[model samples]
Target: MRRFSQFTCIDWSGAKTERPNGIAVATINRDGPPKLISPEPRWSREDIRNWLFHAAKTEQDMLIGFDLSMSLPFHDIGCYFPQWEDSPSRAIDLWHLVDQSSNDDPHLNILSFLEHPQAARHFRHSRDHVGDLFTGGTGRLRVVEQYQRETGQANSASCFNLVGAAQVGKSSLTGMRMLHQLDGAIPIWPFDPIPETGPLIIEIYTTIAALAAGLPKGKSKIRDRVGLEAALQVLGAPSPGPLSQYDDHSTDALITAAWMKNASRDKRLWHPTKLTNEIAQKEGWTFGVF
Candidate 1:
């Protein structure tokens, strides 16, 4: 098991704005508390990517986690898009397709593909337009999503659902496009082999990471300075002073980064039995789920 010298977590936003209210980033070294990197104001996805690229060049081996679904459900139909022609047969292929389709989209926005006649066929964009592609129902969960339930965590949203605040469909789509851009630069765990020593990216659910640090469910996002510092202390993180005004997004990223720093030493998270070759190629595994 290779130990990461640094850990980072991003609380991603799917908004199609230059700077979204939901975007936040946090990072921690091996012996320190996680610090909020986007504390001054809201961050954009592009800004986050540039920061990561810079960190990759300057930092030691780091494990970066994004709070978003890496891929859609493929276990049910053996493919993410079952009835669509030229549909991607694997998860990486889907990332490539997203990248290719949204080549003209600035900032990796996914609106271009969302309205495409052929590409949009695979996505259940709304409640009325349910097609052969993935639709959000309790029964059609991906294998990795099932793991979320088995682990006593809240069941994750289907990547196909494109509505509501909890919906991750748009985020996952844009994230795939960005992942394609970063293909050769960073290895995404399970989908790509983690290197012996280097910066790597992984899919993470902040809720799972928060639970691992003994923070009670539904009450983990602490905004007050005292509460935030106490939660960090539980994760063995140093005190984070003076949280005059903070939101859940920053709290989520900070806690997740701290938990990731601690959880990186667990070898079992790297090689899950659920991460079969097929799932690795299609439905990517969520880090720390297994």
Candidate 2:
């Protein structure tokens, strides 16, 4: 009986361009611990494609769990009119939106349509777009076909997750704390803590890893898991500092310090929060919030 191979990846952005650096890949073969693959920042799209293609060809029993969006648009655009004056813009510059954190409410953004009612009603499935002969005389069909066939993946558009929005919320909290501590201090709003994302990363990785490991989705069991602790240790996340000021660098510094401590240890760092009563017993800690 041959064992199946399992691959797990965490992608920072679902977009192709940023994926090289943000992607984390881990493979679990039969019985031993999983092997994690660090992101190769220099790996080009072609390089990744070739790697996946070669792996798929060689490993008949491989099962990949990509953090990136694999599905395409639910409906196809019948005829893409690239030259038509009325045609909507197909070239979307999504990079600018990448830095926007997810901790905040996303209903404020135009791209919210991807996850909202408008997209549900008007979005064309990538499958439909590629399955049908593009009628509008656009050459994009070739690109679609080549991408699909070569990648052995779907042709659908990728969507961002809610975590991205939550980062904004975290930043907001950081800013508010700063104002309170500073009393309308000199460098008011001098730093936006929205980008202090190590905590968010830690939380997300914990959740997803638990999900993949068939662990319970709630707080208590997740925080106790050794594997989750190990990943965080690898990430070297800092402890949440005092709610004094909303300092971006301070928050980052706190996490960096924690990472350093964890880095020096033989053991890994566990998920910080929990749903159990144990949290109440812990020093000045509260749970079920944030």
Provide TM-scores for the models.
0.92, 0.31
What TM-score would you give candidate 1 relative to the actual structure?
A: 0.92
Tens-digit per-residue lDDT, 1-290, candidate 2: 11233322322222324233423344443333444443445433334444554553454344333222211121234222323333322111111121132224331222332333322232332434321222322223222223433453222222211233222222212222222222211211111111221111111222333322343434312222343444334553322312333222222222222222222222212222322232211111100011
Candidate 2 regions off by >4 Å? 1-3, 6-12, 15-20, 39-44, 72-209, 212-227, 230-290
Cα lDDT listed for each candidate: 0.79, 0.27
User: Can you write out model 1's per-residue Cα lDDT over 126-225, one digit (the tens) per residue?
Assistant: 6687545545464256798987787776568877777676788888888888788775677788877778877889999988877776778776676667
True-vs-predicted CA distance for residue 155, candidate 2, Å: 23
Over 4 Å off, model 1: 39-41, 127-139
Instruction: Give the count of colliding residue pairs in each prediction.
Output: 0, 24
Top-lDDT structure, candidate number: 1
Best by TM-score: 1
